[model samples]
Target: MTPYDAAHSQGSNVLTDGFGRTVTYLRVSVTDRCDLRCVYCMSEHMTFLPKAEVLTLEELDRIASAFVGLGVKKLRITGGEPLVRKNVMGFIEGLSRHLRSGALQELTLTTNGTQLEQFARPLAEAGVRRINVSLDTLKPELFRRLTRGGEIARVLAGIDAAQAAGLKVKINAVALKDDNAAELPELIRWAHGRGLAVTLIETMPMGEIDADRTDQYLSLSALRAELESFWTLRELPLTTGGPARYVEVAETGGQLGFITPLSHNFCEACNRVRLTCTGTLHTCLGREDAADLRAVLRGGGSASDLVDAIRMAVDTKPKGHDFHIERTLPPAVARHMSTTGG
Candidate 1:
């Protein structure tokens, strides 16, 4: 048995936060560099971290294995665009052993879909069953304006490639008042027609961008009320181990999800934590509390030490986040979502 398996054999290592919530999901950011600079996610001229500051691929594997051994059932690889990271596929393949051994129940990712065409087949072969692609708008010009030169055609092509590779594709659209509000219904229809699950997310208060986030914030509750005019949405009792709340649209016979971080607080059952590429562990997305695991890794800390650090971080997990958007105030968290892992 592997060292990870041996760690899992001890029942005392399971991670349970102070609120009695079990942490079974972990989002690991491989890199804070992306090919496209979405207005909300990052500044057009982003200053990325140095290569030495980020953990090595081997270190990433070691940290993630420690989490799996501590009872993390689902692992989602995220990034400023994870596909842009060199040798990321090899890292993902390395993690697939946990899935094969039943130590991890699910392994997946969230991407901008720009590189899906090149990596889709390899991802499926690496044991990824589903992936969430961030596509804000379908209009070519609007898409370019939103992403600062991202090609919608390329993203669409990548989506097609992912579906062809037998990976279940889900579209994640960050609902913006001025950007894609009108086009969302059409986007939903198109996605549902293609048998893809679409999730509408309220624009979050994260990072300092060129655009005013207060102006960009579109409440999912308001958007849902607007959709009710043309379509009947019935709330479904489904939890994907994420913050999204699902609903079934009667007209399209498709599933739609809403992630309302501002309009609604979906934090009572928070079971996930984010690990940045730099090895910072964020117990809550909207809060600033974090634990650095890179220090332990580089300081020659043992695997048991890594596990103890993770448990201590989980012990300090907050009940919820404090995310609010106002023109008068700064972002809830000073760090960018890219730095925090999507």
Candidate 2:
């Protein structure tokens, strides 16, 4: 039976298909407009996607519903900053109702954390309980300098508001060598006190920062050794077959995660697929291949048909990302994290 036809019974839920692979998670980018001009993501003079081409709420709702119907249990709404989009909470409310029907189990959102304060309470009420906030530094001057126009205080305040609103908050810190690697110890301590999880990710080799082999660009393997002094970190378990190598701070109630895409590719365990803000289905984040979902949607295909297409795309997911950065390997189509869904 086709992956779609097998969806009715959990006993028959298959990760593998005709292509022999399983599918599960989906990441949706809500918008391409970001408040912070993070040096890595863009230039001070970067131009964003035209508002006309961006997907409307109705379009997003339709595509998201189709994914859930295909047995996608986890959904993460990403963006230039998902909250910057108009009526985003309404979209979340609509998604929550879908989850209530068993097509979904978790609905999460990722943001830069600058606009969280005003949004936290209302967003929590709208049924968003999990939040991943990107925070590169704790130092004001450095934070502003790195994030360009971001206010560290505002981001921190947003974190507080979200925590107060009872959202499960996690801070994402993308580190480079001389930049904020030194602040990892302090950041981890702060997160533990507030019961928040912290994930330190390596900067993908792209954008202006891609060049300049400065001391700022450190690897994930190195981050572990750097933190050994402060806390006795022990490996924890995964959630829903997650691929991150997690470690808990034994003394504190906090945890740390490492997404070492470059050093250690998790291609074998990659069950996720990406959809750009415009509606292209990306089978691999580091692969040039993508199936055009917009064409199918605009062609007046039914939602069930869309789900079947997703299953086919998922089954054919590449064995692993090419780390296509090295000159020896062919490059994936040049869509960076900022342009694609972060």
Candidate 3:
């Protein structure tokens, strides 16, 4: 029997937090390194975790398996850029077993789309049907300015490659007031024209970046009202299991989603947790409390011991996160979104 099956046989496979939220989604950060440093995500001069500090691929798989054993149905591999990690495809292929065995419902990743041109076909072959690509703007200069030095052409080509590979692509754009606010209408129309779903996220106050987050933060509620002027947005009663709420666009017959953590709190139904590259389990993205799964793993703990650690961590999951954006205050959480597997 598989580890998950063995755990299930023991009858201790459910993971429920203190608020009675049954945790079902796990986002794992394979690495803290990235090819491009976005202004909103990282500091101008960022310091990454040491190689020895990050968990190995095998360790990641083992922990993820334990989570699956504990009723985690969806797993999303994230990173500063997950594909940039060496031999990550093999790691993803290894996890495909749970998908085949019906223990896991979905296996996907959120990428910057720079590496999609090369990894798209392999990803589809590994059973990843849908992926979230981060694209804020289509303008070459603005894209370059946002991602520091990333080429917009490469990202577009990567998106094209992903579509050709039969992978359903969803665009995730961070709503920035001074940056992409005016361009959002064009961006949404472009994505809908291509038969792709787009999710607009408010700029979160997560880490200490060169730019002030207060200046960048845009409320999705306000944005939605503005979109209603040009396009007919009908609220859809659908959820993909994350915090985003969906709406259908009448003109394009496509879907548009909003992830508003700042303007509107989404923690009431929070059923997700983040696992950092260093094996830290963050019960909530907006909170600093975490459990050290790496310590449990490296200390020669047994399978049951690891499971117990996860359960103990879930037991302490906060009812909701404390996320606020004010110029006078620091980040809600000192860690960057990249570190916590955005």
Candidate 4:
């Protein structure tokens, strides 16, 4: 078996989980509130979480610093809709200052890109290196039907603005049944022509999104098989055994990636942990989380205490996900992808 040297290791075993998965990536969810009412995340009668229940700016900073101190080298800021949150720029700027020495090598974000045009430039200036835009359809009518905002044009413009501001742009598409699945090649061509990295993600069966129909998720292996017919794929030397099936196209500009949790399970080599908007630290995406950082923060725990908590969380990583065993996750926890910081 191959081993990870943890190029970004801090000489401390605090970051490696029980299975020896050194956790260097941290996904921080800024808010659980999103304006869109997509069928996947929201039901018709869905209600947003209260503002008071969310983490404060100080809390967020403390948690982020704690993770950074514990050897997390990469962080991605996400949200239900981060742009909607007030003082987001200030928040990013604060994170930038704390990570001034560049110990945090990469800090980026994933957004619906609805408000990217307006905020893209400022975000780039505030130390965000990359931007991942979630776009499922090229047709405006279908975009509106699938996404609550119904604004495909704006998202397209946002991509342009982000690229103009010198941020590495990646197009993130969630292939859904009877929708954009058939259009993968077209999207790949478009992204390559525009010098954008393209990532196809499988539908995560969690919470409200899972309550209905999760059986429709297509596996990454199948997606790759379909792509190989059109493009000559050469392997790239990325972290091996990763969830994202990454390959370089012979003629395509940027590489192609697939995030597969169902058809190809990657929990055995999972090397990341997520901190939700509410300050809960989730060890894995497909399992019920047993540890949380919220209690420590609220209980006046020190940064050292936070570090110990993180180490303990890593020590308890599940043996593996139960996709093959047909084990179901807890219903209450699966309701919101935003809650998982995916």
lDDT on C-alpha atoms for all candidate structures: 0.92, 0.75, 0.92, 0.74
The reply for model 2, stretches above 4 Å from the true place, is: 1-19, 207-215, 240-242, 324-333
Model 3, span 1-342: residue lDDT tens: 233332442346789998899999999999989988999999978999989999999889889988998889999999999999999998899888889989899999999999999999999999999999999999999999999999999999999999999999999999999999999999999999998999999988899999898998899999999999989999999988899999999998999999999889999999999999999999999999999999998999878888899999999999888899999999999999989999
Each prediction's TM-score versus the true structure: 0.97, 0.89, 0.97, 0.89
Candidate 4 deviant stretches above 4 angstroms: 1-14, 239-242, 323-333
lDDT of 3 at 103: 87
- As a whole number from 0 to 100, the lDDT of residue 123 in candidate 2 is 74
lDDT of residue 182 for candidate 1: 90
Off by over 4 Å in 1: 1-11
Q: What lDDT tens digits, residue by residue, belong to model 4 across residues 174-216?
A: 8675677787788888888999978887776666642344444
Q: What is the alpha-carbon lDDT for the whole of candidate 3? A: 0.92
Candidate 4 overall Cα lDDT vs. reference? 0.74
Note the residue pairs that clash in candidate 4: 206-334, 207-334, 207-335, 208-335
Question: CA shift at 207, candidate 2, in angstroms?
Answer: 4.8
